[model samples]
Every structure is written in C-alpha cells, then in structure tokens.
Target: MSKVVLITGASSGIGKSIAHYLIEKGYIVYGTSRNPREKVVNGINFVALDVTKTETIQQAVKEIAEKEGKIDFLINNAGMGITGPIEETPDDEIKRIFDTNYFGVIKVIKAVLPIMRKNNGGFIINITSIAGYMGLPFRGIYSATKGALELTTEAFRMELKDFNIKMTNIAPGDFATNIAAGRYHSPIIKNSPYEKKYKSTLDLMDKHVDKGKDPLIMAEKVYAVMQEKNPTIHYKVGEFIQKFSIALKHILPDKVYEKMLMKHYKL
Candidate 1:
C-alpha cells in the first residue's frame, strides 16, 4: 500500500514542490493551503488549512484520517517570513511569525501524532531554515522561531522514539521561492534609525535567495528520508557553502563565527 503523506503550505514554493515529488514517488499526497479557493494543482489534493488556527488544523487532520485511515508522513512546512531590525519589529509581527513558524508547527504535530501512534509508526519532517542555527542581524525573530522549533524537535525525538515515531528537522539554506513576496515587514522599519542598513541587508538576503538551490534537490532529500527505515535526527538541504557554513559554526570560535557571518552579510 502507498504511504499517505500530508504537507502544509503546499500552495507554492518548497511545499508544493515536495508534494509533486512525493506523488511521483507513488505516495498518496495531500497538500494544505489557507485559502480553500485557491486552484488545486494537478496530482495533489489541497486541503484548507491555517496553521495558526487550531480548529482548522484538527479538521484537516480529521478529514484526511477519515479518507486515508492512517497517515504515514506529515510535513510541517507552513511558515511565513518576517524581516526588520529586532528592536524595531512590532510585537504583533513577532507573534505572527512565531504563530506560523513555531506554534503552528506544534499544533499540526499534535494533531497528527495520535494518528501516527495509532498506525504503529510514521515519519515527520519539520521544515526549518539554516538561520535557525544562529541569529541573523535583521531577521532575529525568524531565527528565534526556527531555533525554538529545532530545540522542540530534539525533545520530540527523545519522547517519541518509544512509540517508533520518527521526527527529523530538515533545514534548508535558501531556495528559490515566493517566500520573498509573502514576507512580513515591520512598519516601524521605515521610520527606524537603522532603516538604511536594514534595507541594504534585506537586499543582500534576497540576492542569495534569488540564487538559492533548487527546490527539487530539497524534494529529493525529503524522499530519501521517506525511504529510510531509520532516518537521521536532522538533514540539511542546500548549496555546499551553506551546508559547510553550518558545520563551521559548530566548531569555530564564537568571535570567528560571528566575524564570518558579519563579513558574509556585510554587516
């Protein structure tokens, strides 16, 4: 029997690409979007889901459970981007970022865990970012959200092993996607003293994203994890430089790593 897989934020970008890839691999794929009115993509079922809303999450999981009987994989890919000086970022903006990136992920995982437990075992891939490993100059909150998620995944890995449920944090460096368009920016950034620097940094960030690695490569990584009988606790998808930078951060001295980041981002 084909595995039943559900991926959030599948309307476009990495999630959408993953959904397509999984379908090609013969997994039954269900992709979620906040707008039910969005046109459905061929070969993928789109479910209405707003990760910020608990009711919608429960309903989406229930709807899938009713039809599929069991969920074999859950991809927590629904997230939004926020940018601005951390000092100038509005409280609401910070909350919104965490809501979609951190809390939203927790909600979906909670809703799906019981189903996975009932099925004996299942795999969960949480879509995180390389920024989660360290704080960036202007995107501190976004980093914080992903950092919180990575730590939470670590805890989940230990707690869920007894039930045979596999959880992995899939951190991608940068990918060509529509995330730039949907990214949130604090209004205060316009008036802040650091506006010029913020704008320049934001442009630099976008430049790298524009040249980001292929989403198909990320999909392949996801598929590889799916094929694993026992997957690793973490997997990264991105260009060699980005992957190497992550390793370098771990072993390098704090000042050295900080200088490297500062030089790279021109901060």
Candidate 2:
C-alpha cells in the first residue's frame, strides 16, 4: 500500500498543487479544506477541516486513521496573511491571523501527535515563508506569525526525535498563489500616518507576487523532500535571488540587511 499523506488548505494554491503532484506519484493523499467540495484531482481525497477548530481537525484525522490505519506524512500548509502598518493593524486582526497561521498549526499537530507516536514514525512538514527569517515592511504581522512557526517547528523537530518522527520547515520565498486571496488588511490603514507609504508598498508587494514563479516548483521540492530518508530540517524554495536574499540575511549586518529589504520594496 502507498504511504498515506495529509495536507491542509489543499483546495487551492501550493497546497492543491502539491496534492496533485503527490497523487501523480501514487501516494494515498488526503487533502483538507475549511469547506471541502466534491472537486477531485486524480485520486486525492478532500476532507473537511478547519485548522482553527480542534473538533474538525480531530474528526479529519480520525477519519483518515480509521480508513488508512496510518498517516505517513502531514503537511500543514493552511495559513492566511495580514497587511498594513503594524501600528494601525488592530489587535483583533493580529489575533485572528495568529489563530489561523500559528495556533491552528499547533492544534492540528497536537491532534495528530498521538497517531504518529503510536505508529512510531511519521513526517511533519510545516509551511513557512522567507519572511519568517526577517520582518518585512508593512507585512510585519504576517512575518511574525511565520517566524513564530519557524521557531516552533525547530523545537518540534528536536522533541520528535525520540519518537522517530521528523519535522521539516518548507520556507518558500514567494510563489504565484492565491495565498493573498484571503489576506486581511487593517481597516484603519487608510487614515493612519503611514497611509500613503503603506499603499505604495502594498502595491509593489502585489506586483512581486504577480510575477512570482509557479508554485509547482515548490511542489516538486516538496516531492524531493518526501523521498528522503531524513530530509533537511529546513528547505528554502524560490528564485536564486530570493534564496540568496535569505542567505544574505544570515551573514549581513543588521543595518545592511535592513537597507537591502528597503531597496527591494522601494521603501
């Protein structure tokens, strides 16, 4: 029997693309969506799951485990983004974003831990972003959430070692996806002190996203990771320039990195 795989936010974008890729590779893939539809891609199964809801996550895992008797790999790719000046973004908006991007991930991992533990081995892949390595202008909150997940996944990797389970962080720079489809914007941005700058910066941000590489590249990277007996703890996917940017952030001085980011976004 093929190894069973579960992916969240599989209705579209990276999640959906990866699901199709894995299906083509003959993995028994179970993809989740907040509101699942009858849409089918090859043999990938869509399960109704809202990462933020513990009950739904529990049920989805239960259904999969019951039928497959094992979950060999799990990809937590469900997340949303928020944009605007950090000061103008309301506390509630930040909370909602974290609830979906950070806390929701935690909830799903917790729900599946027991099954993986019982099985004695499994792979958990968390979808992070290049922004996780550094805060971006106007998208600071979104950065914070991914940054939190990055650190969290690192800790999870260390702890899951004893169980023979593995955790990896897939940090993609920017890919053409509808990830921004459900992105939230601070209502007060229009009247804020940074209003004009925020608008221009956001426009530039959208332009970059529009020209981003196909998400299938990331999906192929994901496939490569799945073939590994022991994948790297973190894999960065994107254009050479974008991946180089991540490397530069590590070696460059704080001031230098800030200048680079500012120049890229024309801030």
Candidate 3:
C-alpha cells in the first residue's frame, strides 16, 4: 500500500506544495485547512482542521485514520506568522501565535500517537523556520514560537523512540508564499520609538519572502527526508546566508552576532 501522509495547513503556501508533490510521488495525501471549500483538490483529500482547536485536530486525525486504516506520515505544517516589535506587540496576539504555532502542534501529535503506536511505527515531520535558530528584530515573536517548537521536537524525538516512531524538525528559510498576507502585523504606531526601524525591517522581510526560493524546494527536501531510515534530529532548507546565519551565531561572540544582526536590519 502507498504510504498515507497527513499535512496540516495545506490550503495554500508551503503545505500545499508539499501535498501536491507527495501526491505525484504516489503517496495517499490528506491535506487540511481550517475550512476547505472542496473535499478534495488535485488529488489531495482535503480535511477540516484548525490547529488551535483541539476538537478539530482530533476529528481530522480520526477521519483520516478511519479511511486509511493507518497514518504513515504526519507533516505538522500548520502555523501562523506575527511581525512586530516585542514591546509593542499585544499580549493577546503573542498568546494567539504561541497557541497556533506551538501548542497546536503538540495537540496534533497527541492525537496521532495512538494510531502510530498501534500501527507499529510512523514519522512526524515539523515545519519550523530558520528564523527559529535566532531571534530577529521585528520578527521576534514568530521566531520564538518556532524556536520553542524546535526545542520541543528534540525532546519529543527521544520519547517516541521506544515506540518505533521517528520525529524531526525541518526549518526552512523564506519561501514565496501567501504567508505575508495572512500574518498579523502589529500596526506601525506613529512616533513610537521603533516606528521607522520596525517599518524598514518589515519591508525588508517582505522583500526576502518575495524573492525567496520556490516552495517546491522545501517539498523536495521533505520527500528526501521521508526516504531516510535513520533521520537526524534537525534539517534546514534555505539560502546559504540564512542557513549560515545559524552557524555564525554558534561561533560568533554574543555582542558580535548581535551587532551583525543589528547592522543587517539597520536597527
């Protein structure tokens, strides 16, 4: 039987690309959205799931399991973006993003674990961000959420080992996607201390996404990782500079790295 793959947030962007790619490769793909207009799209079996809602997450997983009899792979790709100066960002907004990007992922994993364990084994791949490796100026909240998820996956991998389940994190750099349109932007407050610099940084971030790599690159990378028998704990997919920044942080002095980032963001 072809492997069954479940991908959340598949209505658009990177998740959609991954769903299409895997379907072409002969995987039985179930792609989800909070609300899907159609039950299936271009070979992807669409399911309704809201990452922030535990009920929706459980229902989606149960629906897929009943139909397929087993879920061989789960790509936790459901996440939202937030961009703003940390001090200015609303407390409610911060909590909302964490609920979607961090806690939501944990809920989905919890819902899927039983089927994977009963089926003998499975793979869970988390879609994180390269930004997660380090905090960026205006994008701090988004970075923190992904960072938390990244760390959680490290611990999660070990705990799942005894059950023969494999888990890993794949952090991708900016990809050309509709993420910018969907992300929450803490309004650019007039005359606030961070106004000018925050505006500039936000513009630069949009440019990076506009020129970022094709989502298919991430799709291909996901496919490659799935073929691995002994997958590593973390994998990054992005431009050399983005991936290199993570390495630079590890080796550079704290102030030096901070300076480099400040210089890059023109803060």
Candidate 4:
C-alpha cells in the first residue's frame, strides 16, 4: 500500500506544487485549502481545512484517518505573509499571521499525533522561510513566526522521538508564487517616518519574488527529504545567496551582518 500524505495550503503555490509532485511519485496525497471547491486536482484529493479554525482541522484529520487508516506523512505548508515597518504594522495583523503560520501548524500536528502514535510511526515537514533566519526589513512579523516555528520543531522532534515520529523544517528562499499577492501590506503613510524606506523595501521584495526560482525546486526537496530514514532537523532550498545569508549571520559579527542586510535592502 502507498503511504498517505497530507499537505495544508494546497490550493496553489508551493503547497500545490508539492501535492502534484508527491502524487506522481505514488504517495496517496490529500491537499487542503480553506475552501476547496473541487474534490480533487491532478490526482490529489482536495479537502476543506482552514488552519486558523480548530474545528476544521479536527474534521479534516478525522476524515482522512477514517478513510486511510493512518496518515503516514504531514506537510504543514499553510502560512500567510506580512510586510511593513514594525512600528507601522497593526497588532491585529501580527496576531493574524501568527495564528495562521504558527498556532495553526501546532493545531494540525495535535490533531494528527494520536493517529501517528497509534500507527507506530510518521513524518512531519513544516514549510518555513529563509526569512525566518534573520530579521528582514518590513518583514519582521513574518520572520518571527517562521523563526518561532523552527525553534518549536526542534523541541517537538525530541518529544516525538520515543513515538517513532520524525519532524523537520524546510526553509525556502524566494519562489515564484502568488504569495506576494496574498501578503498583507501595511499602507505606506505619506510623509511618515518610514514612508520612503518602506516603499523601497516593498518594491524590492516583490522583484525578488518575481525573479525567484521555480516552486518545483521546493517540491523536489520535499520529496527527497521524505525518502530519508533519519532526516536532519532542518533543510534549506534556494539560490546560493539566499542560503548563504543564513550562514553569514552565524559567521559575521552582529553589526557586520546588520550592515549587509541594510545594504541589500538599501535601507
């Protein structure tokens, strides 16, 4: 029997790409969207699930477990993006992002854990971002959420070790996707303190996404990780510079790395 895999935020973008690739590779794949109008897409079973809603998370997992007997793998790819100067961004918006990106992931994992424990083994892969490794200009909230998730996964892995459940975080750099469209951008206040710099950084961020690598690169990386017996706690998939920036942060002094980022963002 083929393994059963569940992926969140599968309606489009990176989640969609992963669903398609895994299904083609012979895994029984179920992809979730907040509201899926279709029953299936390109062989992926589509289910309705909103990470922000606990009831929906439970129902979706229950339905899958009832049908498949066990969920062999889980890909927590459901997350939203936000960009704005820290002082200018709304508190509600920050909470909203954390609710979806961080809390939502934990909810889904909780719903699936019992099923995985019963079956004696399972794997979980979280779709974090390279931005999480550092505090990027105008994208601080987004970075914090992913960074928190990364640390949580480290602790989660140790807790699940005795249960034979494995967990890992995959941080992708810029990818050509509709994420830019979905992101919440705090309005640029004219003549405000951060107005000029915020506008410039926002434009630069979009350009990077426009020229980003194909989403399939992430999908390929996901598939490769699933094939491992003892996967590492973290994996990064992106261009040389994007991946290297994370390394530079560790190797360079605090001010030096800060200067590099300020230079990159033209702050």
Q: Against the hidden reference, what TM-scores do the models get?
A: 0.96, 0.96, 0.99, 0.99
Cα lDDT computed for each candidate against the true fold: 0.90, 0.89, 0.95, 0.96
**Looking at candidate 4, what is the lDDT of residue 6?**
99
Kindly report which residue stretches of model 3 are placed more than 4 angstroms away from their true locations once superposed.
Answer: none
lDDT of 3 by residue, 141-225 (tens): 9999999999999999989999999999999999999999999999999999989999999999999999989999999999999
Stronger candidate by lDDT (2 vs 4): 4
Model 2 alpha-carbon miss at residue 70, Å: 0.6
- For residues 1-267, write the lDDT of model 4, one tens digit per residue: 999999999989999999999988999999999888889878999889999999999999999999999999999999999999999899999999999999999999999999999999999999999999999999999999999999999999999999999999999999999999999999999999999999999999999999999999999999999999999998999999999999999999999999999999998
How many clashing residue pairs appear in each of the predictions shown? 0, 0, 0, 0
Better of 2 and 3 by TM-score: 3
Candidate number of the best lDDT: 4
lDDT winner between 3 and 4, please give it. 4
lDDT of 1 by residue, 1-267 (tens): 999999999878999899999999898999999886644577888889999999999999999999999999999999999998887888988998999999999999999999999989999999999889898899899999998999999999999998899999999999999898899976544567987778888898889889887898989989988888888877888888888988998899999999998888777
Worst 10 residues of 4 by lDDT: 33-42
Evaluated at residue 51, the lDDT of candidate 4 is 94
TM-score of 2: 0.96
